[model samples]
Target: MPIISVTVGVALLLVLMMVFKLNAFVSLLIVGLFVGVLEGMSPLEAMESVEKGLGGTLGHLTIIIIFGAILGKLMTDSGGAQRIATTLIHSFGEKRVQSAAVITAAIVGIALFFETGVVVLIPLVFTIATAARVPVLYIGMPVIAALITMHGFVPPHPGPTAVASVFGANIGLTMILGIIIAIPAFILGGPVYTKFFKKESLEIEIPKGLFNPKEFKEEELPKFGISLFTALLPVILIALQTIVQIVAPESPIAPVTNFIGDANVALLISVLVAIFTFGLNLGKKMPEIMQSLSEAVSGIALILLIIAAGGAFKQVLIDSHIDKYISDIMAGSTLSPLILTWLIAAILRIAVGSATVAGMTAAGIAAPLVAATGASPELMVLAAGAGSVTFSHVNDAGFWIYKEYFNLTIGQTIKTWSVMVTIISIVGLAGVLILDMFI
Candidate 1:
């Protein structure tokens, strides 16, 4: 009965979102309450579980998401992102433009979320494609692929970072393994696969006013060195702490390093630096900087609500015994935990159409399995992250973003953008499995 309720709960969520066209926040709340009651909990108990989930998830994530958004907004608005793009394009030149586009996108993507990164990098994608005399898809595929991969697999971008918090995965370790997994995924899905795109299909016009680089004067952009440092500062601080903890276990600075190296603290510091470097240092007034920060928070208000709702749904599953029921079922099976984790996330992603929602829900369900089997939380995070991005088609906002940006028909989008993400997913799963062998 509990198992049936679990299946029905997910199906109801999909129908509400995809068929009825209900709001995801309302739909998730409805499904959470419905499933909890069906699973034999009292109605009040179910509601309590939902509230607990909402508070727990938001308590851990609110600050990180807000700080990340502020930094990203500052980076985009102050011309720092354009600075990095310009430098990478010049250094790579026309001959190596493909590699350059991917690198620039990856670096920029790290600091900006997937959607914002796309908005910032689209101009550069078109610019590079025009300069290299290659098809737009040839260059654009690598750029989008790199950004999507980072959004799923890496930290400080919300999805992976939030899942890491839920599963107790070490942020530093997840970042390390995610980078290792992401490089090959990017190469295989981005540049390598791009060679096979039909020449005729690549002939798409750059959409007018889709964030043109010419809008900003070269002198107005920040220097490349400062831009790059500001963008990657959080990653550096976190990685440095990880390395130090491993090598100098008894150092007196451990406490200080741990304090600063904390993901929340590191991002807070980066946000402060960005406010000074991109805002004040660029001669922007205090009011202007404050507006950017406020607007950044406004943009993510819906996303935060959806995340909280998903967390509510997650709590219902955990509290109502669905996670345990599923864990017990898996216990009797011979499947690998990593593969199982990926499959569950992939299924939910296909159903829910939001990678963050799918990843969070899947992590909640898979939590019991990790506890029962003693699986490595880091690999589980990567595996779930990998699944959350698989088969990104019509349901995903990214699919539409790709389609509209490239001016592709639905079929063309499935052939190009969808296929690229499928490749990333497969490559991500394979990487996690391989990593599991040595660890």
Candidate 2:
């Protein structure tokens, strides 16, 4: 009965968002209350479930998202992103501009959120497309593929990091494994997928105001190395902690490593460094830099709420004993926990169209399997994350973002963007299974 209620609840969510065009945050909260009632909770009890879910999820995510946002905003505002793109493009040259764009995308994707990455980089992508005398999709596809893969699989990108928290996966280990898995997936989704598309399909007129051909003067941009460092600092710090804990668990320096290497602390330090490297040192005023931080925080208000709502929705399932219903079925099945988690997330992604919501809800249902089956939580995070990007269609904002920006038809978006995401999803699961054999 609980499972049946949850199934109807998901269907209702799709109707609220798709048919009635409700906001995702509001829809999720409504669905949370609906599911709770269906599972036999009192109104007060259901409201409490939603509150605990919202508070628990936001408590972990807010600081990390804030610092990450500031770091990314600074990188974009001070020309650090430009510096990396231009230098990489030049290094690889016009002949390999696609390679350069995708590389820049992968690196920048590590810092910026998916939507932010798209808006910030699309102009640069168009500029690169023009200078290189190529179709926008030639470079755009690979760039988008890289960014999407990172957003789906990598930490500090909200989707992956949020899911990682739900699964209690180590952020550091998740990032390491995420990057390892994301590379080949991106290659397939990016470079390989581009080759398979028809030339006519890839061609597009630049959207009027999205193209900015004026380059930032070389003197205006930050140095490539510093730009790279500031963007990657959080990763470096967290990863070093993970490594040190493993290699030298008893090392006196482990204490120091743990302190500085925490995901929050690391990002905080990176933000401070970026304020200097990407802000004041670039000749921008302190107030201007602070203003950028304010803007960064403001931009993510809706996204943060959506994630919090997802958390609430997940909490409702757990409180209602519905997670046990699903977990019981999963435990008795012949399926691997990893694959099953992916499948649940993939289905939710298709129905709901938000990776964070899909991954969070899937984790809630599958997390017990991690302990029951002894599968690695890190791999489950990756599996759920990978599945979260399974199919991007009309429901997915990313699909429309791709379709409109590159002027592709709905059919073309399916042939390209949707198919490419599926490719990434499969490759990601394969990579996770392979890693499981070793780790």
Candidate 3:
């Protein structure tokens, strides 16, 4: 089959799944089979490829994502996120809730994965918006926007990490660029946009039992300072490792860099801290602590499954040589890898309704092109991350979450959340392109 035919077929398959409401996992599996057969593989070979792809990809990411989800759930359920938000809001003052929302979201994003972060913070967002007598969108957009920015651009989060790994980017450089891009993107998509949304005055009843404010009774809640430190410990350690490696290449810290700042190590430390701060110190029993941990991890089952399926889809694309063919075709074009990465990611994101999938698939397809052209791996990764976050629609769970939570019509959700996401995507791509010029 012609490469164009394969591309169109794959595109159509995605659209049908997303638009016609087919299951994404099933769609991906079917698309993979179709692509494999069309590419001349035998039926048996295609089925084997599906299994191999799913197993291999899940093998790499399952533990990391599952653990990350658990850590996030612990923090959230234990009121750690509330501690951060309330403290920040109080410190920033009511007039600057927008700024506070953005900061909290960024911090939470660094600590938690995208969906986990959203789930954790949405309650506090509602509380704050209510107290301020503003539309929920006013508060919600800034927080979610900040989370999206960090999830796309920062490390320790799976999207950027996956992109960095695929592109051979320096984790340190990617982190640096991610922060730089994140600040501006957050401001644009967040506080600034919040002002506009506030004017619309959409009311949403705060969900009951979202967070038990009583849970934070003076003696029950961890000290705000301790909770903040515990929340940030992993990110701080990872950033320290990245900085040391970049600045002191031969330093003694080199040996321990991976050990101290590795995802597993950082998360382990956070989990331990959570036990002490939220469980032991809070007078909870050992059994309760264990239950909390298990519950937190279990909440992430759907996220893990979706991510695993995405990985499987990516592997299938690789096995079919579609990635290589696309790389070859784009290699001769004048399009910069940065722009190309973003565009491909955006297209896939809009088509598939999963930013992680879009990022992973785009990175896989663009990796070969980056190698062929000697493009900066860091820029390529950022571009792919940016692209993966373009336009959100009804197909995207985030879109519906925002719409229902904020009580917005679909139009309003698009006008606000969708627009903010598009801005993040575009600004992120621009940031990568500008950085490319200098680096």
Candidate 4:
């Protein structure tokens, strides 16, 4: 069965990486091919799927990460990152650093794509952790948890927005409800969960080349307002798009918002803005700015490859028709439509490695159940949204991104990134169930 093969494939992948220590990119490639052939594809067809997956994923991710990395690199070298870090540390103090990270992520993540938020905000994680004398995971995990929670549960994010549309849920109401549900979920999953970790979770090396966490003295740092603006420009631009789409969908300026608010375009604009704000305005030369861009691209070359390979593995599983198999099996279930949709989306999330893909696919199965089971369409949307990010593991690009950016091994990622997402998932479900009891 495809499910059995997929399970075996994931186990073998961990064995290859954790036991034998193969390069992650190569390890993913090997397993993608292995799983494809095991599921009955010929070797040549599997190779083509892998190539297509790599191309498709890179096509979208490359420019975004390139700009994001450059933005991060400029902030890192110019002490913009330090300024933000210092402000955060001073405002929140060392003990509450993770709280600061969570709040920052929540604000930016409301509009920014999760990947964009990660690249932009993750640099500050290094700075904060270093300045506060804490582990990178301590600050970083909560940041991602908040971002991922919003990505999975809230509207304007592709996954939940698309799922809401399919369910005919009121987008505005769904968003309000989502935010209400998200608070406790991220609080427990992010800050509280990190606090319960063993002392060793407190130790992590900042990833080399990706960021510099220099603790610059106050005089050397740029003004805090400009640094914060530089980091938040993308959020503002993207949020404008969503606002226009909802408030004035047919406005003449909608076309303009759509253009600039595209993630790639927004990041590019942010980079140019950063060039001036963090670079030229600071009296740095063009060559120095260009040099920072070069270093940023170089730092992520390996990270990009690992992300593509993850996409490849996901493509191979997708090609094997595992989602169809699972859907067919669950079609006759009589569970609560909310819980059933959540289960299907959660399983598909583990199977497909993309929350949007998982949520949309689950929508196809649960769309009819809205009428059949008498569940509220809004709650059903929230429930499916919850499940779409459950148990991120080897098949997920997000899992690899977290692993690479935070410089954690598979074991550490499972313990931190993986577990944190699961916590958010469960909280979302329970919260939805509680809300369902009333309305």
Each prediction's number of clashing residue pairs: 0, 0, 0, 0
lDDT of 1 by residue, 366-420 (tens): 8777787778899999999999999988888999999998888999899989899
Candidate 4 C-alpha lDDT tens digits along 1-439 = 8768766776776677667877777887898899889989999999998898788767756776567667767776777755664576678877888887887787656645677668768888887788878887888888899999988887656567556655777655677688889999999999889889875775787777885435566666779899888877766676677688879999999999988877678778999999998899888899988998898788768766766676677667667665455445546766677898899889877865767656765664566676556678889989999999899999888999999998889998998988899999999999999999998
Candidate achieving the largest TM-score? 1
Residue 33 miss distance in model 4 (angstroms): 1.7
lDDT computed for candidate 1: 0.88
Clashing pairs in 4: none
lDDT order, best first, reads: 2, 1, 4, 3
Once model 1 is optimally superposed onto the true structure by TM-score, how far is the C-alpha of residue 399 displaced, in angstroms? 0.7
Query: Clash pairs of candidate 1?
Result: none
Q: Which runs in model 3 stand beyond 4 Å of their true positions?
A: 133-135, 170-173, 196-215
lDDT of each: 0.88, 0.90, 0.76, 0.78
Alpha carbon lDDT at 155, candidate 3: 73
TM-score of 1: 0.97
Clashes of 4: 0
Ranking by TM-score: 1, 2, 3, 4
List model 3 lDDT by residue over 287-377, tens digit each: 8888877886777666555555555656666677877887777768887878878998899899888887788767766777776677999
